[model samples]
Target: MIAANVSSSHGEKPRKPPVKVLSSQLREGKGSAVGGGKPEVSIRRLGSRRPGSSGSLAVSVVWMQGTVLEAHTDQNSALLLDETGNFHITGVKNIPRGKPCLSPGKYVMVMGVIQSHSPEPVLRAVKMADLSHNAAMHRKMWKYEVEDLQQTLPS
Candidate 1:
């Protein structure tokens, strides 16, 4: 006759296994942790590819938290400065002719879709806001390009 052995501890606490989930639920939108989808706003540079677009707007490579000196435009170009450094490029595109290009030292809010290609970062300015007095990290968002600019300038 063969002897049978029985287990001493029957149902000890079962070991908990790992659970996998989507990264969007994570706190930082990273890994498997849960998070909220909140749009991020930052002071960054902008670049335009098709300046002729009637609706879309384009700006320059903005360097955040830097000084933009009021420099004179010699040949239909505006110069800007920011944390990244100095940039001399064409003024905002798709504005009525002779509209005074935005001056330096005028706080501005830039909004648009962010795009990265190869080794560069650019934002297609869907909207822009002037902020000169309020000294905050972010600025108030403005209306869409066509509706806003059209109202400001003469037709």
Candidate 2:
């Protein structure tokens, strides 16, 4: 059975694992968060991709946390404010029901891919969670964790 299974699999192509990346290293196309590499990044660096540049970073998945500056439920989008800058988040309509609300002043964590980087960077959220219950604590911890990861990276 083992020999047969191995022979059958040999004809199929192996799938490439998704590349993990940090926001700062997105352009450089570095490692992922689970691998002890820089995972999260500031909003300002999310739009670093230059037009016409080709790489996995162009569509690299990212995890970002910020406060909602404004929400347009009718439009299914929101304005997210982070320490570095503001980011446009779309696909709010896709968030699962009973999750946290996307109101102004609410802290949220968004996991998504970069949809575009034209006039501004837009993040098409695949998942979202409200962090307002303990926003301060979460923000501080995230800051420290990112700093530590940055230090471990090669200078």
Candidate 3:
């Protein structure tokens, strides 16, 4: 099984590095969204996987960046708006110690797995980092980086 730990804490089990993907690539089934290497997939793609397929039971770790549209601290969830669409993220309180707080209008980076795809795509966050300090620059840079990776990386 592919472990999906993003933390560097010692004594923990080994984990796979997350694949960075764009919300659009995830939604449209375009770009480098397949292969024998890392699992690059969207919520729809993940939901389509049948049992017994390769990595079917493995963790599908992904890294994404978006802006917080709304935060429901009481429910430990929030609405994240990426470039193409909005994603419902849960387990807000799971962020590691010293991470920035999640709040509306704040740009943040989320590392998580797709939890569901029925009503909508939901990301079960394991870690989150506030990037509001350099939102504009960071967003642009992230866009270019993802695009470049999608083109160069094998599917």
Candidate 4:
């Protein structure tokens, strides 16, 4: 449902938001509900397509906090959705390992390297902290997290 009211080709007419549907959803007819029309989808990942191709191996570390929108996991790897994007996190290190340690709707703080810089950037999470799934608690946590993050910035 996230979209911008962009100007159309015919001048000034507000364009509709582009809806992206997962393949499974499309198969299940979920893609047809957007404004009673078929939703458009792109095959490639949504983010910066290229990383730094320069000779410099400089990797910048940063932190992000967002509600978990989606999650996927295997025996060795895990993915969790965030505002920037779904991050591919190393499942073994600094993560609470057990059945359902992370799930949809959990708030989390992740520290990682930006693999790409798109609106939904991909990050390789090095460490993470669970900020609880409660909205009130998460908001309180955000205040503290922001304050801590602010101190790290060169002001």
Rate residue 97 of model 1 by lDDT. 34
Query: lDDT scores for all predictions?
Result: 0.31, 0.56, 0.64, 0.43
Model 1 CA deviation exceeding 4 Å by range: 1-67, 71-74, 96-101, 110-127, 139-155
lDDT of 1: 0.31
- Model 2 misplaced regions, further than 4 Å: 1-59, 147-155
Query: Could you tell me which 10 consecutive residues in candidate 2 have the lowest summed lDDT?
Result: 1-10
The candidates, ranked best first by TM-score, are: 3, 2, 4, 1
lDDT of 3 by residue, 11-53 (tens): 7655556666656545554222234443444322222334444
Residue-wise C-alpha lDDT for candidate 2, range 32-110, written one tens digit per residue: 3423342432222222234453223323355667788889978988887666567787888988851356888988888
User: Which one wins by TM-score: 2 or 3?
Assistant: 3
lDDT of 1 by residue, 98-133 (tens): 124357776544333323211223333333445556
Worst 10 contiguous positions by lDDT, candidate 3? 42-51
Q: Per-residue CA lDDT of candidate 4, range 1-155, in tens?
A: 22346475775556443222112211222111123342322122222223432211112334556656556555444555543245444442445542254566767666654444333345556566667646566645554544333332221
Q: Best by TM-score, which number? A: 3
Candidate number with the higher lDDT (1 or 4): 4
lDDT winner, 1 or 3 = 3
In candidate 2, which residue pairs clash?
A: 20-32
- For each candidate in turn, the TM-score is 0.29, 0.58, 0.66, 0.43
In model 4, where do residues sit more than 4 Å from their true spots?
A: 1-59, 75-100, 133-135, 140-144
Q: Which is better, 2 or 4, measured by TM-score?
A: 2
